[model samples]
Target: MAVQSAPEKALETVGPPSAVEEGEDARVRKKKGTLQDRQDMWRIGREQELNRNFRFLSVLGFTAVLMCTWEAVMFGSQYGLLDGGAAGMIYTYIGAIVGFSAVILSMAEMASMAPTSGGQYHWVSEFAPPSCQKFLSYITGWVCVLGWHTGIAGCSYTVANMLIGILAINYPDSYVPQGWHGTLFVMAVASVAFIFNTFLAQKLPLIEGIILIVHCFGFFAILIPLWVLAPTSPPSKVFGSIEDRGGWGNNGLACLVGLVAPIYALIGPDSAVHMAEEIKDASRVLPLGMVWTLILNGTTGFVMLITYAFCLGDIDKLLEIETGFPFIQVFLNATNSVGAATGMTVIIMILQFCAAISNVATTSRQLYAFARDNGLPFSSFLAHVNPRYTVPLNALCTSLVIVCLLSLINIGSAVAFNAIMSLGVAALLSSYIISTCCLRLKRWRGEPLPPARWSLGRWSAAVETFAILFLLVVYVFSFFPLTRRVDAETMNWSVVIFSGVVLFALSYYFLYARKVYSGPVTRVKQLM
Candidate 1:
């Protein structure tokens, strides 16, 4: 018998369960088994051992906390201001909100259709042409896996830097942050995330729910105080002023480089896609969760950017503050009390820690899925799900180890580590481009898609086209150096690092993987 394709298998599974034939064995088994037993055996067998504990609200909370838009702007706005000034910050944020909204909508539609933990790669295999499907899917899986691994390192590194920033506030005269210090802090933060992902795995949804409340309410906690205490700038200065501190000569080039900041902030909403298997009614819930995350973060992030622009005072002095982040300087200048600034910094730190934990969860799930599909070396070991916890224990451990190794880069060269962190945007956007482009091609060719619970219907073509084009443009800019004169220290290493990852993945595929890996296995019955 010929094997069914993934799309066909998806349709078969979604259809009504195959009826049990009536006979002695069937009747006795039907009588003994519950109603669920009468359902398609293939469908039941396909479900990997993961707990589908996430409801719509819980998933929304998870995605919102992962995005953490307001917090990101607070810490990452320096790059925007350095390149774009106040006007660039405002307009770039608006553009990013629109652009990323399109990107996520396209991804959400794919999630609705496939609803698998493999996310982009799985979609690529389903939609890509048969001849290139395996190769494309394999490379996409590696890119996503490495993108998320770097993302974990980036989040933990930021948290570590912030913690050191707080210490600087307390001891301005004596505090000096060393590379080793940041590395140690990264390890510390990663350890906390490991504990949560392994020991407290079941509490993730509830924890994310609580963090969502903080994500919303915490906006007021920081914003209200800043607005009340900080001296405000004029409308022109807040909305029209442009700065080119990076010596890029052309203001337009500066603005393009600055776009990376907001793009980075908007990149991880797709983190929820990796959790599809662990989400209840994932076809509908995943799309709803992703779109709502964008709306909530986009609105809050825009307001926070505006607030930052207006409250910014004495640019030179703020930039000169001993703390690594300019936002800490903003707090100090506004409050004029080290104690108050440190307190507010602590709140942001808590939220950052929560976001790091969520990153770990997402990274592990993606790794688990890819390994389950035999897309990674040591697939059996990495894909093992813990019976007791119903979590990917081995995969989580593997991610933790890789994160620890990546954090070591901070010790030798913070600049190089930063370049690695910057890979998140370029790497992820490439994956988005491939998957969305595949989707658009399939739609354009009128290939019949499996029915999707959450779909764009009439608007799907336009949205996918826009999303693919937008990502292609952004993917190019994500590699531009921040300053005109690039040196070892100032270079934007995203392109180099991203290129190296792709090269390694392709090299591995040609050397060993192509023979063993055949894209996603069609035997759903063997998944468990």
Candidate 2:
């Protein structure tokens, strides 16, 4: 994005002068802090926030829409199912049920209430006990930053690697870059995702729309091959019985590690809700988007999952296929159609391009919301919105830069890159848990923050409770070290990720966060 227009007189230095007064008052109020507590609750449709400018239904639908097929491709392939380590378990019915329960219960309400880009931190500041507000919210923001950015990095890497796999499978002799190929490809892909969003931010929905159509159309296109050519295979032979694969016991922890497959695949469905303010009837539409995405992607993904399982004649052969994607082999087996498989592969690539484009918007909105209130360190730069485009140029660029640096990590340490992505899960899960815990606490105490036009009603409390417990379990499991000895070929990336999250959180506490970093530039809402 072009540099934002020069703010007239440094944008009036953002926060109102009264912030100083409020800061002083906050200190005095805390001195007399009681369990009764006090909250700086602001009205929902305040001057600082532009209530709802965009069409809510469109934006909400768009957010959750594409997630339907995105993960189907991921989980339907070997990477998420076979190699994503944690996701393998997640693709299973039991694991998906657990994840579904968590998302519906916990994240749904939090997204409705806090709806800000800073996500966890913005939420923490408004809700946490007055005394611990600074530390808790700040940590939540930092951790969430890790989760959001690392999630982007992970997708970039995953897509890059998949593209490379396409090349290695099709053109074995082609001169692909060595050792650092992934890093280079990651850079290139990030550039594409960034350019589409930055220069063309306004047209994003159109592009997103096109992507959605293609995703749906492509699913149909590929189904023809599975039905026509692969009809001979049946569930009895192809999909292994629980007894055949040693069910859950023999797989042991390896199965648990596979949870990442579904987790990664189902990720970003909530992206639509993040753009709540941009949509027309956001309250009505956001939840609808979630349901739409869930149904669409859920149905397609399950079909692919079960079909692929049924079609596979040999699990070992599927695993040993030289090309990283074993599903191509499934197509080859079912239809004896490399040509069709190749076609499907191309379709997926196109859809992935679409997914990447959507991701840029996702990251931008997040950065914009965060910087709007000066949540990040470089508030002055990141908070600037391009007057012409009405987009947050600095935040967009910052996101791009983060992804580029993350890509470089693939060259220096592949394990580090993987670990970062793993930690991302923990980061996101933490945000979900904290937000729901806050909601429950708030409800229990009868505190009135702004209510959403759309709400879950009495079930809100129960949903949040279930979500909190589920996320806690998921968080603990995310940190559980992968068993590298089970497969020495791949490094145990979990330890590095778990440790990195700790360092980032602790470092924030040690450095700038101690004194500065007032939770979400509430004083400067107009600037955002």
Candidate 3:
């Protein structure tokens, strides 16, 4: 039950790191390095099993593509356009960038301190009150895992439907869209992600490096066409209009609801934090990768949003388009050529597919980390790293199966599948709220924190406080349906699904995990 505070004792005395070493001396040694010391301080049992193939640029690429903000803006613009219009989307997006900046900075500080693949849960384990650490950490792990799985589902859904959209665009009259079609594509996307994360895990850095080039260039490719070819809206409409088509009855509330798209686009900046062990100079590179990805993606996403606003053509017609996506309509309007629009649409699809691939990797790593600490069923199997590939093959397989099953929900009801996917937003924000709140409580009590290579220095208090307050507001609105009048079809059932996940996790804990699970903190109790 005791927690360890010193690193040297843990390294020297806690056996041989863990079962997941490259060789005898490649990872663990008598002489402690800074990375090892930090890992020891956090009681992370797993050695450096995954290759440290990711440098700053690759990490940045991974985070950027995972978020894929500009592409998300286009994919999700329908909600914003109907509820909040051009002015609303733009202003809310700018606010999101500002609000999430605080979040990114606070998380960067925590990543510097712990730098573990467990991310928010691991930080909660270390920073929460010692008497309550185990329960809180266990709950956070479940929430974090739920958030990640939902994220993969959401990204895969986007990628699959966009592929369908392309078909609809080309065969407008003959191709009848079916829910089963989307489900099949979703499964296909998940299968591809599994293959890449398993067999091609070592080549991720190089792959992401290439995608990063495409991520940047694709922005200009889409942007220049909109600027040159699309018909422009007046300044008043682009900057002053507020369309309240959602029947929210209040423009402000409608705009707030519309913020979901932009916020969802920015949700995964902590992505790099979950891949910390695979990143070289994790304490330093993790923070840099996270913060810079936010800044870089935010700038480009903002410009894209504004450009889309100007070139949006007709919101009402686009919303009812056959393809079921508004951005395709926008591109078609801009170029007046199906071939040109398909080319641009394909760019977004490719980036989103890439996001799905990285999302699978990140989610699997988190699952592996949680399992390593006995937080889930079959912990030992799920936590096993293939000694040859250095990848958690079992965890990756589990995640793939989960994704395929979740996709089945779409076949039954697209609305229900959407509700399930929405769980990611609420679940992730809950983890962020808990972790940042725990960090602030420690700081307020003047408790000593783990050494941070990327400290916020004098501004840490303000940043953490703002992050909590802002995330709480977003969390509440995230569960609000786009309309005031809700039916089973229109309901935002994410809150309901999230509660179900919470209930299941708590029941599992009390029934089984309470006895078996010790939380990650106890692993370092000997060093204290």
Candidate 4:
């Protein structure tokens, strides 16, 4: 008997192909019994749709901009300076990059094996025990959805506060930074992001590419001037200074609380993982994009931290500057010209705003993916994609509404808004812990996983274990209040809100979702 040619075999399996059937047959024949291959086969089978508009560089750019590492450090440095002082900030940042790298590496491996917009939840469903898969995946989805949604609010809030900071720089005594001002700015920033996501969706690749350029060179643009003109603190001051402004009593507790800033900066490298469906060769490209983005951003963030510490002149004056941003004050002092300082501040603001834009895009994709699995309140409408642009217009609008609603908390209490921001970090890390622990359990059971284009090989177990342990530490500290003393104004409400989200998800699952939701829907048939 002669072996059949590829086309002949496809025809035998799928029958004589019309134009559309012919393309489907080709994809079906290419399935190789791997998890990624199964996902592709499923997409073709179910007629699931997302245009593969991102190439490697574009995806990398998207991931890099989403991290916005140096920008985050600048925006969030106050926490570190207040709690850990210069020494604590510098050392904690280094520790965070190391710990976060482990988590990213583990996530990248799983991404290579099962690339999907469903991301952590999908991986959890695949690796979790059959008896609990539905419940586990359902809760994971909710956690991730809330995390990304709050992420949009958090990033936009940063942009909003920065804009106000700029205003305060120009207006000084007259420009009082109020809670309402931040809230209004958040609405404005989110609105712009919504317009870009809907009307200009097709241009995202180009936009991200340009933003990546700015994210990289913008570091040097700010750094060189500060280094050249700013009066430097002695090495002792930069490396050895430690303060307890948090009133935490114990210096150790203060340092632990300060870890939140750097950890939050590293949270969203997995943002690209949610765009798996939009990237060409997603299994390979997704992991590469994630790991490389971490490396690039982590390195630059560390260098930027050192520069800020060394160039930090009068700590007392910086803290008192009306800008609400220490870096802006540092820039002004370094240049000795408000004009140059404002120009540099504007550049950072642009990068931060670009980050908010990318945050909305990624968050909407996560929303669309969850809704497609019938996980949300109005799944049908929320999951609808605009055919012309192949973007989730409805989901984008829905996210905008939720973010705006959440921003309202800022008006009543900035401390409350801070809790919502903490929810983003805590919720995301919770999802990470669940998915990673599931993966580790599968490996420990000696179950076979599909071959990955990117593999950890002999180091898989060690890396996964370290990732889990490190994330557990970060998760615990994320809920700690910056100030030791508790007041309505100073209390950390993340624990309260995070617990509420979990309780609601569990209640909804038992009440309705368990009967209807069956983990991720298998839109494709098994190729074997």
Candidate 4: Cα lDDT at 340: 90
> Over the stretch 1-528, how does candidate 2's per-residue lDDT look in tens digits?
012123322433333322223354643433222211111112221122222333433453355443535444442344333433222433453465556655753555555554544556666666766676667776676666667777667666656656666666567677454548778877787788788776776666666666666677777777767767774445444333332131234444445555555555565666764555454434455656666566667667766665555565666577676555566667667766556666776676666656666666666767666554445667668767776666677777888888888777644233454465566777777766776677678788887655554577878777777767666766776654344443433565655655666687678557754654555423322212
lDDT of 1: 0.80
Could you tell me the lDDT of residue 311 within candidate 2?
A: 63
- Using lDDT as the measure, name the better of candidate 1 and candidate 2: 1
Candidate number with the higher TM-score (2 or 3): 3
The candidate 3 region of ten consecutive residues with least summed lDDT is 29-38
lDDT (10s digit) by residue, model 1, range 291-409: 98898888998888899889887666665565668899898888999999898888888888898999999999999988977788898999999988878899999998998998886
Shift of residue 503 alpha carbon in model 3, Å: 0.6
Quote each prediction's TM-score.
Answer: 0.91, 0.80, 0.93, 0.91
Q: What is the lDDT of candidate 3?
A: 0.84
Number of the top-ranking candidate, with TM-score as the measure: 3
lDDT of 2: 0.57
lDDT of 2 at 383: 67
Candidate 3 structure quality by residue, lDDT tens digits, 1-528: 354333334454645333344464745432233445445433554455667778889999999999999988888887788779888899899889999999989999999887888999888887888888889989999988999998888888887788888888888889888888888988998899888887889899899999999999999999999999999999887999988888999889999988788888899999888888787768888998999999899999998999999998678888787676789988888898989999999999989999998999999999999998889999999999998778899999999999888887745343654475568888898899989999999999998787787899999999999999999999988888877888978898888878988999999999999887777666543333
Candidate with more favorable, higher lDDT: 2 or 3: 3
- Rank order by lDDT, top first? 3, 4, 1, 2
Error of 3 at 223 (Å): 0.5
lDDT of each: 0.80, 0.57, 0.84, 0.81
TM-score of model 4 vs. true structure: 0.91
